[model samples]
Target: MDNFSFYDLQPKISNFPDEVLAGLSKQQKQIPPKFFYDEYGSKIFDQICELEEYYPTRTEFGILQQHSSDIADQIGENSLIIEYGSGSSQKICFLLDSLIKPWAYMPIDISREHMLSASKTIADKYPNLKVLGVYADYTTEMLLPEYAISSVQKKVIFFPGTTIGNLEPEEAIQLLKRSAMIVGSCGGMLIGFDMKKDPQILHASYNDSKGVTAAFNINLLTRINRELEASFDTNTFTHYAFFNPQKSRIEMHLISLVEQTVVISDRLFNFLEGESIHTENSYKFSVQEIENMSERTGFKLIRFWTDPKKHFYPG
Candidate 1:
């Protein structure tokens, strides 16, 4: 297999954090979710997947293991497989084994190092396959690769790992719309979504016994301190993740233990006592909720497979 052509290895200039920060100043408080996938963040998240309490990965993988053949048949042969957030490319083998003859593989992610390493491994393993590695932040507005964008035929869009949970409802819809436009109506999308579960279960997934999730959450602050020259007391903050039943999602944040002032680039920022910086949200969906979501986004549910024991509720 040869390395495939990429749309754009570098992100568009306007996608820089300085641009984002300037834009966010117009709002009360804001943080774009793309920062969560820096190298360290990605590693910590991989640790999160290995924890006993995190059931989404195991359950979703089980469903794929059981129904890859069916899924492949539905997707058909000679189709291009484009995956979003293609971390490690761990799950692609199962689908590739089933598909047997895919036209190309496009793996997109913000972590260029990981994407580069994983894409190389994938190409080596899947001889005769065209593998294109894209290092772009899909959350930010950027032009897709010309080849993919200009293709008259639609290709399959694969968004696994339940990363869709990171998006707000409206954002998720907009993302799907962008994907649909890229793939067109002829190409379909296959996604994995974590189902809603008990608050205890949800919270434990992010605050596991190993504390890897906690480390991952705290690493965000560490990253800002290092990169943006912001002062963040990691020890003074604690990670918190809990299911909001009403919102049908698990919200993750770092709560400040006391009032504090932090300096960044010669500017001081105040934090009130017991205040928190909301970091991430993992929205867990019911089957009906996903079905409604699919319908609203002009996606017809082709098939949904799940491991019921893991509380998998695919639609």
Candidate 2:
């Protein structure tokens, strides 16, 4: 396994309790979407990507397939590709297949088990390429392994999933700034973002006809209950999702069907009937918005591309 290695910057579930408690304590009870990737949660999300109504994954992949070589040319030879929230490792295959000679691949994720598994699979496929699985929150400030940087001719962050939509603009800027730290002075980021499109399309994607999206939303509660010793009657909560056109984002929430109190580690939290715990936000952006984000974060937005239908884009 010389070509493969994994590093855990944070211990297993180390900050889960504190983060959960903090999020629940808010006036508008909310949980960070990052918590949605414990091993089981990660697998559930992979299912989410394949749902017929969920269009981002496939649309982004098409864009990559159409322009991977062009994208690879920009990335150049002997480069490093570090994916943010590296789930499943499916989409990166297109770019890797087209690249000249990628020196290394770093899949950074909060879920250690998921990241390690994905990295190993990738390493097995690309024997000549170095695979470094980094188990850490990419949003948190950190660096690539000191040893990984010296020989890489170019460093590019391959953020393919529009996961950046999960954060608020301020938080997104902070993350990009931290990423700037890893890629160094000349490094760049290639990211995906859904543009502001039909609100109904946005609504349908998150509120899929199949119940898989519901399960994915509820799994967050299941994780809290299992890992934090909470008593959450999962059946009493219904999955709710909709597009908020004003904000240009889809918001997912778990609505309490009945008034109840849940206890986690002896901490009591009460819920009113119909009240909701906000779970996630997926923001849609226009090209100018992405360019503005790059400018704010000190990274220049070099180029952008989209599918034939223009449903999704990567820049």
Candidate 3:
């Protein structure tokens, strides 16, 4: 048995630099998107996955169930399976089970607990499968561990869950380019993208009536308070999300319910009543856009499948 070391992806800001802190304080209310993955936030997200309105997880999993054999056939043998944001390794099991043979399984994630838990489960179920879990964020520039994969084998990057939507166009392209460099010339990439659809359908998916998404969004502040020793009134903030047609994204925000001042260590920040801080934007993509992105980024579009009901684009 191999002993796995735990890692955290948090940026080490020893001194919350005055200028940067001041800039953040200038906003009536402000919170960065990175704070959204505390243990509580991750648990809430798992709840959101079970929600009826949240369709991406279920729809994408369904597509995999139906076409896993075909997808596995295309991937072929002796390729290392690498997944981005591989949490719990739940959805991935479908594909791996269907594959005839694979050299290794590398799941990259930001959470050390998830990486360890998921990797252990996979290792237990598939005795012969080599499992390597990387505790790092693949979105940013970082050197991947050399031992994670064999230099001689073909690489296949599995970036499912419409995660590309989290990035802007340029960032998405850069990620794809990185994938190209990692996989080399002979390999392929499989990914998922939520397709453009009716405004109502798209809007309802994120801003569900049960408000689980809202809880998850606001939970980011709670994480910041706990991790950074900051004082934030979680009850004084509310979550807001809307479809921005101009940007073609679902923008999420945390609006202050009342004016207040929060202190973090030595700095004091003030917020105006009803003001908002932008948290994240999830950009959806058209099929053509996805294909073009792949082409421009040096990956030929292998094959993509969508549910017959038109909910998502799974490849």
Candidate 4:
């Protein structure tokens, strides 16, 4: 446990309320996807990865399992590993196992409890590795841990689970550029990409039959009700997700079952029947788009590996 350190940089409580009010005030009601990671939401998302319809997680896992040795060869030895949105810390284990004498592991996530628990577990399992759990929204500008800067030989960012797909292309470029700055000129990044696939497959991934995806989507409202004192009737709002071909993405929205008004901290928001609050967008990519993004973001596409069916890419 001495090898592990935890840092909390999550936003103040008032930040959520402010963001929600501003988003709801928009002509197109929207909520930032960051809100979907409250403790409960984080647990629900772990369940989502195991669903049969969700192929990205398992597919990417397979790609890593098959090519980890080659990937490790590229990353080199004694490198610092920084994982963004490090939920559950499952994939990092494989990379750590394959890498030669990885100097440290830093798992950055918004959920404090989840980040701490996962970091501690990784530390216990790899007693020789330094584990630092950072509680911050990696999507925003963040100061990397001072110790990670001075103690490690090289930095390698492991951003798996296609989480980058959540951002628009421009936002993705900005994030990659930030990551490049964090790792410095000598560092490299191994990122996962969810490839463009059949619309049916994309739709099924977000709309699982067991309703776990629905539950995961609805957990956002439950979080708002609990944390913001928002009067959101969970039963009156249903989860809806679909692939938008024009956008090359899957959009998750919460649709109102009836006309209603909800009050959050003295702020009132109204919704008509069938009106939806846009929650998340997951953008799929092509190889060409990824190459273009990498070029714009200051990263050279040194290598990439995909699953047998080519559903996912880890590069």
Candidate 4 local lDDT, 199-237, one digit each (tens): 999988899999998998898888888888899999999
> Which residue pairs come into collision in candidate 3?
none
lDDT of each prediction vs. the true structure?
Answer: 0.77, 0.87, 0.80, 0.89
lDDT, ranked from best to worst: 4, 2, 3, 1
RMSD of each candidate? Answer: 2.7, 2.0, 3.1, 2.1
Candidate 1 regions with alpha-carbon error over 4 angstroms: 1-3, 13-30, 140-154, 313-315
lDDT of 2: 0.87
- Candidate 2: tens digits of C-alpha lDDT, residues 30-88: 98887787778768888888989889988998899999999999889888899988867
Report the C-alpha lDDT of model 3 over 203-257, residue by residue, as the tens digit.
8888999999999998877766776688889999898888999888988888889
1-315: candidate 1 lDDT, tens digit per residue: 355565556775344447334523432333555666677887887778878998888887888888899889988878888888887898888899899578888999877777888998998888788888888977666566777556536588888877788889999988877776677788889888887767788778777998888898888778878888878899998887787888888888778898998776676666777777777788888878888878887788878877866576433
Worst 10 residues of 4 by lDDT: 8-17
lDDT of 1: 0.77
Q: What is the lDDT of candidate 3?
A: 0.80
TM-score of 1: 0.89
Q: RMSD in angstroms, candidate 3?
A: 3.1
List the pairs of residues colliding in candidate 4.
none
Error of 3 at 83 (Å): 1.1
Error (Å) of candidate 2 at residue 26 is 1.7
